[model samples]
Target: MKVHFIAIGGSAMHNLAIALHNKGFEITGSDDEIFEPSKSRLEKYGILPKEWGWYPEKLDTSFDAIILGMHARIDNPELLKAQELGLKIYSYPEYIYEQTKDKTRIVIGGSHGKTTTTSMVMHALKDNNIEFDYMVGAQIEGFETMVKLSQESKIAIFEGDEYLSSPIDRRPKFHLYHPHIALITGIAWDHINVFPTFENYLNQFEIFTQMIQENGSLIYFDEDEHIAKIIKNKREDIEYIPYHSHPFKIVDNCSILKTNKGEIPLEIFGEHNLQNLMGAFHICRKIGLSDESFYQSIQYFSGAAKRLQKLADKNSCTVFQDFAHSPSKLKATTEAVKKQFTNRKLIACMELHTFSSLKKEFLPHYKNTMGSADEAIVYFNPKTIEHKKLEPITKIQVAEAFGGNNVTVYTDSDQVITDLLEHDFNHTNVLLMSSGNFSGLNLIELAEKIVNKY
Candidate 1:
């Protein structure tokens, strides 16, 4: 198989390219510019393009398929050439579906916890000697790449995303997967840039439930009201399984998950993670894993990258980081840390990074989401707003949207770091949340400074 990628430097695209390349397939890709990690990884595979610009003349009838990335525009020269030549063109999700059509697809979908839940399932499967083709949104601890494809694997696990698939594909990425075993962890309105309204956003998951293969299982979190409503109109052909926070009790900073066999201590804590773990447990059961087997493997699973990942700890304070910028994710992350460390002060910081989070209209959804934090700080770069062609918003707007006296807004990330440096964090837990870089702020370095400063 020969696959040509239009925007090969993307986090997902590059991994898929490499996965296919490692399968002994001919892989070629082009990107106008490539950044670190993706650039280095692609070069390591010897598949990096020699030149920058797209050359339509290089594409011929001999190419097997063209996988398009979201980074590419609709009028991309290579895409146009592929269309002109009548070559098979696929969005990332569409191609993944095409490749895994013969396998039992276990798709994890939700506004939050998708990466962590998918990672949990992947970790368990691998630990149990289960060979599976998988695609997750984040890099995990034991996985070499975010995507894995193999001819021998009988199952394919995908972190189903609700965002648009590609520049020309208006449908949500999850809509294309058509999973045999589908799990909706929970739904909170997200990707406002695409869906635009809560009802419209809610409808996508409804459609997703409808798309589940006949007689397949639908696993979900029972506590979420949105998920409850979706299940009310459940399909008749599929079995429905609902789970809660996995019966975990926090004893002296450690989490103990109560199981039918015995109590299993967890390396990970927090309510959201427990909920994610429960959702993953139900999915594993549907895929032929016993409760005891799942528990044994999951005990060794730490977490996905940037999903409440521990960064530094010293002088009785621990600093953590997360890929949480959406309103639901931000609230859950802040609340989870605060709830776990009840005695300690929780200094929760997040950046308005995505198009949805930066929008003035969407800001109000974050109201009281950070209320659990002892000190809440928000940051947004004005230049980012301008670059995204969004309306200018003030610090007052951000503060007012958060709705608390504890909330402090900063346009500059340096100010946030400086303020945090001078603050006393003894017996305090810090949670840094963002889908971005915090305006070039190196969070890992900041975490080291925070813990070692004293």
Candidate 2:
């Protein structure tokens, strides 16, 4: 199989290109810009283009398929050439579906916890020596690539994303998988540039639920009212399994689970994580993992990348960085850190980088989300807003919308870095949350700085 990728340097796209390359398929890709990690990884695979930028001349009738990334626009020359040739073009999700159509697809979808839940399932499966093809959103500790596709594996696990599939495909990526076993973690309105309204954003999930294979299973978080409503409307033939936070007890900053094989300690904690674990448990059970196997395997699970990931710790201070830009994710991450270290002060800072978070109308969803932090800080880049072609917003508006006197807002990246450096790190746990780099503030450096100050 020969696959040509447009905008191949994307996190997911590059991973998929590598996965296919490793499968002994001929892989070629082009992008105008390629960044670190993706560029290096692609180069290591010997598949990185000699030069960046699209070349329509590279498009040929001999190619098997063209997988398009969201980073590629509709007018991309390669895309236009592929269309002109009437060649097969697949969005990331569409191609994934085409590849895994014969397998029992298990898709984990929701506004939050998708990566963590997908990681939990993958951890359990891999630990138990279960062979499976998978695609997760983050670079997990043990996995070489974020995507792994094999002809031998009977099942495919996908971290279902609600974001648009591609420039040509307006549908959400999750809508294409149509999983045989699906899970919805929770719902919060996001992607304002696409959906525009909360109800429209939610309807995508509803559509996803409707797309589930007949007589298949739907595992959901019963605690979420929106998810409950979706599950309630499902067909009777489909199995509906709802899970809550897995039974666990915290002792001396350690989280132990009440398993069938007695109590077991876990490397990861947090109510949301426990909830994600429970959801993963149900999905794994349906897919043939025994309770004993799941429990034993989940013990070594570190967690997905950037979901409360421990960066640096020293002298009672721990620093974490999370990809928690949404309101629900922010609240959950803040609460998780606080709950885990009740004795220490929790200082949380998050960047408003996404389209929804920066939108004036969507700001209300963040009300009280960051209130759990002892000192909550919100940062927004005016340049980022301008770059995204969004309306200008003020720090005062953000602080007001979040509805907390304790909240500190900043627009300058250097100010945030300086403030973080000056803040008392002794006996405090720090969490830096954002989907972005906090406007180019280096997390590892910041984390080291925080840890060293203690």
Off by over 4 Å in 2: none
lDDT of model 1 at residue 159?
98
- On the 0 to 100 scale, the lDDT of residue 95 in model 1 is 91
lDDT against the true structure, per candidate, is 0.92, 0.91
CA RMSD (A), model 1:
1.0
Clashes of each: 0, 0
Model 1, which residues run further than 4 Å from truth?
none
Candidate 1 accuracy as lDDT: 0.92
> Worst lDDT window (10 residues) for model 1?
227-236
TM-score of each: 0.98, 0.98
Model 2 lDDT vs. the true structure?
Answer: 0.91
Model 2 pairs whose backbones collide = none
